[model samples]
Each structure stands twice: as C-alpha cells, then as structure tokens.
Target: MADRELEEIGEDNTLLLVDDEEPFLKRLARAMEKRGFAVETAGSVAAGRAYATARPPAYAVVDLRLEDGSGLEVVETLRETRPDCRVVVLTGYGAIATAVAAVKIGAMDYLSKPADANDVTAALLAPAGDLPPPPENPMSADRVRWEHIQRVYELCDRNVSETARRLNMHRRTLQRILAKRSPR
Candidate 1:
C-alpha cells in the first residue's frame, strides 16, 4: 500500500519535517525515508522557513507550535515558494480554531500529536476533496473530555485556578480530575 502511494507521488519525493521535539522529528524523518521520501528536518520555525524558501519540498509535516514561532508561517512560506506542496499540520494542542486556520492557509490536513507514520502518510497522500477514512481506534468520549481538559490546563500555564475558572468547573473537581490518570 505504501509502495503504491510512493509510486503515485512520482519522482519528486522530497519531504520536509519541522518539529521542535528532536526525538520525534528524527523518528518521523526516518520513518518517512523508509517509506521513500527524501526527507529533510528542521527543529525551529526559522530553519523551516529558510528551507522552504531555499529549496521547497513536495510535501511537509509541520508541528503547529515551535520555540521560535508557529508552524503556520512555514506553511505560508512553502505555499508561496511552491504552491503544489502538500502540507500537514501536526499539533500537540489541537483546537478547532487552529485546525481551521491551518486549512485556510493551505494545509492539506491537520493531525493531533503522537500521530504515527502510517496516519501521516495517508494524510499526505489522500486525494484532494476526499474525506480521510475514520480512525481504526477512535478516542472514547471520556478520553476526548480528558484530552480537552489537559489542553486547557496546559494553555492556562498549568494553573489549576485559571483552568477551572476558564472551564467553569469547580476548583476541587478540576484538581481531582487532574490528579487522576487520563482515560483511554
């Protein structure tokens, strides 16, 4: 299946992967290379932008947040340099607003963090105007709720009071939920 996708992508198999997380970035790069991409990796928005401007790739997998700036800038730069680039936005803090913004700015798809190589490959290769197939293991409602709470908590700088207030949840209740492990 991967071989067929690689063949469909043709000889311009260059791919750029941008992420601040070194380990994850390296792992994804290796995975992509094995799947037939000539991969390049950048650990900051500046590097990503520079690479996009200097040598635009056929595909890109970019993390939404970086130490220097948002990955959206890189996406924009790539689009300007090479409008044919197929880009995927990956984020640990997945929110509807950011996802919409990513797509608006020309990302082919938006994926949450911890996304595996197969999922990323599928997104990158999916045909235009076609909906992606549903996940094999979708998150349960409880897990979804827990993930939302965790995202809010991190956005609030891990301040329990602020997170609870923003969520309209009792401080004690929020604290208890935080104390427990995340649901599956």
Candidate 2:
C-alpha cells in the first residue's frame, strides 16, 4: 500500500470479515489485523447480519455464498445501515451475474477468492470506479463452461447424479470431468 493509503487507514479502523470457510476467514482476519484493522469475523449470513446490524464496520469482506444464504444479503443490509461503509464481495464460485448484482446492491468491489490482504486493502481504499482493469487473458469458452459446471455441481448438493441430470450429461462423463481440477 502507498504511504498515503497507510496513513488513511488508521490502526483503529474496523473491518468485518465474513466467509463460511473457517480457515480462510480466520487467516484473512489475522492478516488484516496485522495491517492495522480491527477485524471481526462471521461464518454465516445470519451471524453477519446480526453483527452488521449491531455495529457496522467501516469496511466489510463478504463471501458471495454463506451457510444460510447469499452474502449479498449482508451487503444489502450494510449498505442500508451505513451507506458510507465500503463493502467488497469475495467468491470462489464467481460469476458475472453475481458480480454485477453485488455492485448494483452497493458493493464497492468484487474479487475472486484467494485475494490477499493487500488486494483487499487496495480495493477498499481506491475510489469504487478506479478498479484495476479486467484480465487480458480471460478464461476460454471451454474453461468458462467447466467452471459453470463445477458451480452447478456444488449447488446441486454435490450430488453427481443430480448434476449430470441437470446438465443433461452422461453420468460417467460428468464424473470424469469433475475428477480433474479446473482447466486454466
């Protein structure tokens, strides 16, 4: 971060870190704290709502999907409670549709999962419109298709049979595709 940004982000600044993934949330909270934020964490949408309702943080990192519901619900609530607070949506199963919805609902930025503390800080500090440009070498059509299939598979409760049926894919074929890690 620039010295100007460091100066702006005071040691007393508070942040809400929400994600269903326990390890990720804890690790990120620690990292952000080291960078001078006072971090509070929640592992579900319900908990996040309660926390935000009680004390809205100056910044929030919300996972797109939580245990009880979409993190978009938390973002919407935060926006209503404290319009000035900056919120960023983070998701492993990122989709253009969800990203657009997050922004429209008042998220300052949307980031794919595994974003580092530096990235989150930068996004929160920069003017909402001053986002870094989209990647040049974006995912290919086949890669996009693979990602979408994986997301659906998960959404279908990780039921291989149901996912195959929904995609109209041969059960064995679907399993084969899922057996491998996502294509670059």
TM-score of each: 0.91, 0.86
Q: CA lDDT of each candidate?
A: 0.93, 0.87
List candidate 2 stretches off by more than 4 Å.
Answer: 10-12, 134-145
lDDT of 2 at 161: 98
How many backbone clashes can be found in candidate 1? 0
Candidate 1 minimal-lDDT segment of 10 residues: 1-10
TM-score of model number 1: 0.91
TM-score of 2: 0.86
Query: Cα deviation in Å at residue 60, candidate 1?
Result: 0.2
Off by over 4 Å in 1: 1-3
lDDT of 1 at 42: 96
